[model samples]
Target: MKLLLIPDKFKGSLTSVEVSKAFIAGVKKSGIPFSSHYIKASDGGDGFMNAVAHYKACISVQVISENPLGRPIQSYYLYNQESNSAYIELANASGMELLKPEERNPMLTSTFGTGLQIKDAIEKGVKNIYIGLGGSATNDGGIGIAQALGYSFLDKSGNRLLATGASLSKINSIDDTDVFEGLKQIRFFAVNDVNNPLLGKDGAAHIYAGQKGATKEMIKELDLGLRNLDVVIFDKYSFLYAELPGSGAAGGVAYGLKSFLGASYCNGIDFILELSGVNDLLTKEKFDFLITGEGRIDEQTLHGKLIQGVLALGVRKNIPVIAICGKLDIEKKELKKRGIYDVFEIQDSTKSLDYNMQHAADLLTAKTTEYFGLLLK
Candidate 1:
């Protein structure tokens, strides 16, 4: 039998390639003769570069950038040669991983480093850029990114809008015509999974601002600040992006890219799958089953994530698809109706998150082994 294994990262637990390896080991242990095709995949989040790198061109370039807190830090951007563009996963520079739990203040953090990375790519003569907007620790409404591109945000008193989410309220004017003179010909395809707007109940501040240590009061302030800025941008440029899907992504970084850089939004998982050559691989091989998964399976997984993307492809090709997750939530019927053949959680039994994370590899191997034995029988 032949199996195609393509999984996303189990968040803090394991990577896609790591999970595939465990499954491969379990199948071998069960004495099952199987031809396995492994596709390390992502939803254009943190490991997008690694996924494409496994099948395409990936070059890492180190550049001086800023951290989530506006501090100078050095980070890398991955360049893909086949696409003739640079893939900048925003997390590499402005991710929550660079900050401590206590430092997870969206009110104070900035995406300036991400802007710097874009500038570096522009300088390298890359005309197309793909950006993954996730795992950021900022709510700056993309002010810092605009600053890096020479779009200055000034207050009524003519002072520059400072580097913080709270400072977005003071914006009185914007200048983008001459900013980043070398970027006029560049095109940006922003891969975003979130559909939140720039400001409102379901906007960036209210829905995701809390993940970055925003309090109720802070959420209110951020919402108002972003709303005011949205008004100004629309009045000046006649571009109303406040309600655009994914506009609130990466703390409104999507809005900035769309307004200033003429970026277009695309689903993250779809982008990754296309860039990784998954379609071409599937055309070259036939499989009895396709196994794909992520860290968790829930209602949210039905959204623009990895498993659903695989399911779509599987359905088109009339192939059965199953999933293995670190944790499975929701009704089995719900998953089955969605064309998922089965879902397995990697935990041996119920335990604390810490324990589950620590033993994920072992538990995953055992479960996969048991499943394979049943298949063999």
Candidate 2:
């Protein structure tokens, strides 16, 4: 039997590369004479630049930037001189992983760090910028980024405001007359997967802020701030983007780029897979099963994530897909109905969450052995 393995990072557990190694070791324990292939993939999250560098030649340009809470940090982005383009991952500077649980209040965080990275890239003569909008820790409606690029957010009294979620509701206007001239030449693209808008029930604050340490009251306030931001943009540019799909990505950073820099949005999974040549590989080889997964297989996994992209490939290429996850929250019947042959939850339920995370590799390997031992034999 031949198998193709593709997995995403298990978040706090194993990396995708480590997971693939565990799968190989487990299959060997099964004593099944099976050949396998691996695809290291990303859906434009934190590892976005790594995925692009895997298939293309690019230079890593390091910069001094700020963390989500405005602390100075060292970060980098991929640059291609030939295309005069740079690829930036928001998580490098503004990700949820950058902050401790106690430091994750969106009201106090900002995307100004990411904006600094962009400004550095622009100063380096990059004309095209692709930013992956995922795993951010802020909900400032993009005002922090705008501020970093030389725009100013002002209160009703025309006084400059600090760029943070708490200040969003106080922003009465934006001043961009002093923005970097190079910004006008830069073409920006937001690589996104989620379809949430910038505000309201399914919007960034309501849907994602809780993950970045927001209380219900904070969420309501952030949502109000985003609404105010939309109104201010409409007043200035005659354009409203709060309801735009994917605009809510990265805590309204996507919305910020679209409104401030004329950025466009693209599908993250499709872009990354195409870059990694997944379709070309499938066209060349016929595998019995395509194994793919991520940290958690939940309702969100069905929407524009790497698994959704891999599932589409499985359907198109007529390959059975067996997905393995560290934790499974979706119903197996639902996945089966959607054409996945099976879903494996590899954690030991008897163990504590910390224990399961620490031993994820062993659990994944054992699960792999059990499955292939029963099926391949």
Candidate 3:
């Protein structure tokens, strides 16, 4: 039997590659003569660097940037020569991971470092850039990024604005002449997973600001700031990005890219799938079973995710596809109805969270072994 295992990062637990290893160990222990293929997968979230780094000769460059709390932090950008472009997970520089529990203030954070990464790629003579925006820790409406890219925001008094979300209220004018000075030949693609706009109730500040540690008052202020920035940006470009899908991504970094940098926005999975040649791989291989997974299997899995994307392909190929999750939440019948043929949860019935995390591979290995035993029958 030929089996293909493609899984996303298990988030806070196992990586997709590690999970594949456990599956292989299980299949081997089952005494089954099956050809297994491991394909590390990501949906433009945390494991992007790993996916790209595995198959590409990625060069890393270090840069100084600000953390969520306005403190200095060191971050790195990865450049791929095969594509003649540089890739960045914007979160690497300004992600929520850079902040402590007490320092998760969205109003004060900035996407400045993300912009610096863009500038770095430009300096490298890269005309095409791929940027993934997830795990952000800011709500600056991309003002800081604009600043990093040579765009200047001035107050009514003609003073430059501060590089924070709170400072957007003072912005009265935008000067992009210097920002646009470079060759207009560059093409940028912003990879984002969310479709929230830049403002309004379902927008960036209201829907996501609370998760970034913003209070009701702060959310209001951040929304206002983004609204004001939208107005100023529209005046200069004659375009309004406030309502563009994914414009709210990374605290409105998507809006900044569209309004100022003329960047195209695409979902992270689509971009990664194309870059990794997923379609080509599928066309070249015919498998008896397709296995896709993530850290958790729940209602959210119905949303556009790596698991769903993989299953879509499997369904088209008329192959039975199973999902292996770190934990399973929804009923199995429901998952099956959603095109998941089978679901496996890797929790030790009698283990602690820490214990499960540490021994996940072994536990998964054991479970996969038993699962393959049935397959052999």
Query: Residue-wise lDDT of candidate 2 within 89-208, one digit each (tens)?
Result: 999999999998989999999999999999999888899999987889999877788888999999999999999999999989989889988787889999986778888888999989
- lDDT for 224 in candidate 3 is 92
lDDT of 1 at 322: 88
- Which tens-of-lDDT digit does each residue in 1-377 have in candidate 1? 89988788788988877888888888888888889888777776678667656766678889999898878888988887666798888888888889999999888988889999999999988889988888888888878787888888888887877767988888888866659887779989878866668888878898788989999999999999898889888878999998987898888888878987889998887877786687887788889999998887888577566787888889988889989988888788899999898888887566888998888888888888898888888
lDDT of each: 0.83, 0.89, 0.80
lDDT of 3 by residue, 38-102 (tens): 77666665666767777679988787766655667787778877778777887788788878878
* Selected candidate, larger TM-score, 2 vs 3: 2
Backbone clashes (count) for model 3:
0
Question: Candidates 1 and 3: which is better by TM-score?
Answer: 1
* Cα-based TM-score, every candidate: 0.91, 0.96, 0.86
TM-score of 3: 0.86
Ranking by lDDT: 2, 1, 3
**Candidate 2, position 195, lDDT:** 72
What's the CA error at residue 113 for candidate 3, in Å? 1.1
